[model samples]
Target: MAASTCVRAGEISPGHDSFTGSPSTADRLTGSVAVDGQRRHGGSSRDVRRGRPTLVCPCLPVVDGLSSGRLDQDEGVSSFRKGDHGEPDSVRFEAAGLRWLGEAPGGVAVAEVLSEGPGWLETARVHPGGATAAAAEQLGRALARTHAAGAPHLGCPPAGWTGDGFMGRAQLPLRGTPGPDSWGEFYAADRVLPYLAGAVANGAIDTAGERTVRRCADRLATGELDAPQPRLVTRPAARLHGDLWSGNVLWGERDGIVAATLIDPAAHGGHAESDLAQLGVFGAPHLDRVVAAYDEISPLAPGWRERVGLHQLHMLIVHAALFGGSYGRQTVRTAARYA
Candidate 1:
């Protein structure tokens, strides 16, 4: 999602007027327009014919494919995401994830993918709404259904995608083949250690911090932290929204009522508790309700609460690698108990 202040349904955010159009009045719009620093191709054919400006955001960074903007077309309002040349497959990866997650029988509502092309992808826009308790509960139930969709193995990527995916701006390791037999092993190798090494190389964490995190990683690799699989999960892996931070969950209007719409996934196959733990990482609204609702449906493994920090270590280390500061310190502190 874009870093813009939340606005009510049908209202536009300040300083983003260039991309605005009346959802009810706009005609079918099409054609590619350069984003970020790319050269403008005059304007979309619809823009030229209708005497409107080409849709573009000048404030976005060149490498930020996740930066989003609104597009009002004849069908309705949609969210347009530009692709990053630096991360060529990011757009396709996200598209694949959305489709895969959406296929779950009773899964969480995802933004509908309207169209996609080489350098851009568009999806039905979710209008911002309050995170009501009812919405939170629905999100919980839906998320459990999504996890129950299952994947082929612990480290498998989305069904059709074979390459590595992106977690925010960082590389998210993935495997198409059957991965390690245990979730602990896959989590250590694909999730924690890679980001830990990056954090150390970037000076985000000191030697002591490295040792502490490595100790936790060693325990994870050895399956010391592995827990019994949830009763509902019959497969070796549960589908996961690899990055389930608060920002990625949009509480918005859906079907005339407020509901959660998941976006910007680093989707993969892993332990289900990781997704539940991530909701608490940055303080999601009504998080307790969400977790309770989820537990009602799927019944998490015993002692799952005690393992929250264990799962959260992956996200913390990724943040440490990307933005060295308190995140590094936080990672080390979180790893100490498990170490």
Candidate 2:
């Protein structure tokens, strides 16, 4: 169904109460694209037509054919507003319960050929620096606000996720029910351990790193790793930009942390700490305050900081798989931090 919708790329409004009671008018979804055609609410059909306008994304051409309107809209809906990681997985907006709430799928990509200046990765340039560090905190806090909005209605429902990461190709985890009963088992077996093996097979990884990952997996699997229980959560689950890193953090207007709008997301119902850990690894701006603010609203475990290094290993491995240069070095260093 979603694959068909992605091909169509038709204007849609979820009929569900996704945005029904939100105070923001933007969150109030009144109608959807009619099965027959475009539907108008109180305003004239002409009014609807008048208000509707086309959006132009610089990277559309490469994406349109790629998505073919066949991507998972349900999963896309889950990723609407997140602390964007640096991928062009931004998608069509869906409804939510917070500031200018909406959902987005990676499938909205459309195609046209052009030797564009820069690219969808403009956010990467906004690295946290002297002044930007303060902004990074603000950005982190704003991300917490986004968290306060409410959880996503849709979920990935897929077990495997492998769009891109460290070396060139690697599979990560997504949200949904797994056959495994515990989040710990699911995370270690399905998430980190798989990538450990994949990285080795791809030649981007080595024996030492592989052994460490396996060891970490063993400890985590056998209850050797110290992890906090009664994890941070939100209804419908946590709204993570999933793949947050330093490059993904953006500077919004001169200074002050603006938005942690997410890009490439392995989005799902999982730990909010995972997102924070990635933010920290890349030296993302405003590291200290981000966690403090988040704790004010959604407190993390007492020892969340200690566990962050463990979580950082996962993302470092991802980067090693994607970039394969210094990132691989970083991956080895970070993984060894535990071993």
Candidate 3:
């Protein structure tokens, strides 16, 4: 009855461990999916047998005993996710993000939000499947369309959402006042600086590393590292899955066909390359196909590959702030390049 064990299809009852399968290579690489009774949740150790409520799947965690499972009503299976304690707006924020992202015509697939309340959100369960080149390619093109949907401004939150959101339990600062025009300024101010400060405050970063990151941030704020606006977009800001790591890109079957479904987004308005760069942070499967197909739809600005490290700095600092281990060192190493 451990939460890490996969629930049997159409069953929500406790104390059943019917699923005995092993996680795939990609799942193992991401450390997000597991069939055994122990696994990591967002890089943090989680053991449901020790007083936490049993989760229906390893990817989704719930609080206050609000576990996800089959409804047994013939409407098919659904996954429930509840907000962590003290984060009241988390579930609502996620619901708004999913709705906004799903609005794009021909965009990447997102989990359908079935219902939501003050502390919990429910979504249709996407059955797990193997990743293929074709699926990755289609995801790439669809992702381009999603980014083309655009946002009102860089660093803006999803439409209809107010206040700040989260990026995997870390406070994700959203746009409150607008002044910076270019993506570089917005990214430096909203994306990198906030998490950098948090990492420092947590003692995850040393004085030397802090100084190095600040230098990088200064250059970024001066608009020195900004890339040209992507073709076919009027706005500078793209609708980004703010936390687009491989763990968030769920490869699964929908409508009897294999495809990618995006989940657990810290969705916002930002540079498109930021999303693309995150795919590389943890080695997304068939990433080359994803990017190539995306370029076919909306050609990326030149020199994008060269700027991957620049774009990836934010997520690294976030990891530093939250996990406080080698992530701090990694953040400094990446920032040293731009510094």
Task: Please list the C-alpha lDDT of all candidates, in the order they appear.
Answer: 0.70, 0.40, 0.69
Q: What is the TM-score of each candidate against the true structure?
A: 0.81, 0.53, 0.81
Q: How accurate is candidate 2 locally (lDDT)?
A: 0.40
Candidate 1 at 199: error in angstroms?
0.7
Q: Specify the poorest-scoring 10-residue window by lDDT in model 1.
A: 24-33
RMSD (CA, angstroms), candidate 2: 17.8
TM-score of candidate 1 relative to the true fold: 0.81
Pick the lDDT winner.
Answer: 1
How well is each residue in 172-250 modelled by candidate 1, as lDDT tens digits? 9999898788778888888989898779888879999999988988888888889966656778789888888666777
Better of 1 and 3 by lDDT: 1
- Clash totals for all candidate models: 0, 33, 0
Instruction: After superposing candidate 3 on the true structure, give the runs of residues whose Cα lies further than 4 Å from its correct spot.
Output: 1-73
Q: Write the per-residue lDDT of candidate 3 for residues 100-129, one digit (tens) a residue.
A: 899988899998887777766667656677
Task: Report the Cα lDDT for residue 195, model 1.
Answer: 92
- Kindly state the number of residue pairs that clash in model 1: 0
Cα error of candidate 2 at position 302, Å: 1.5
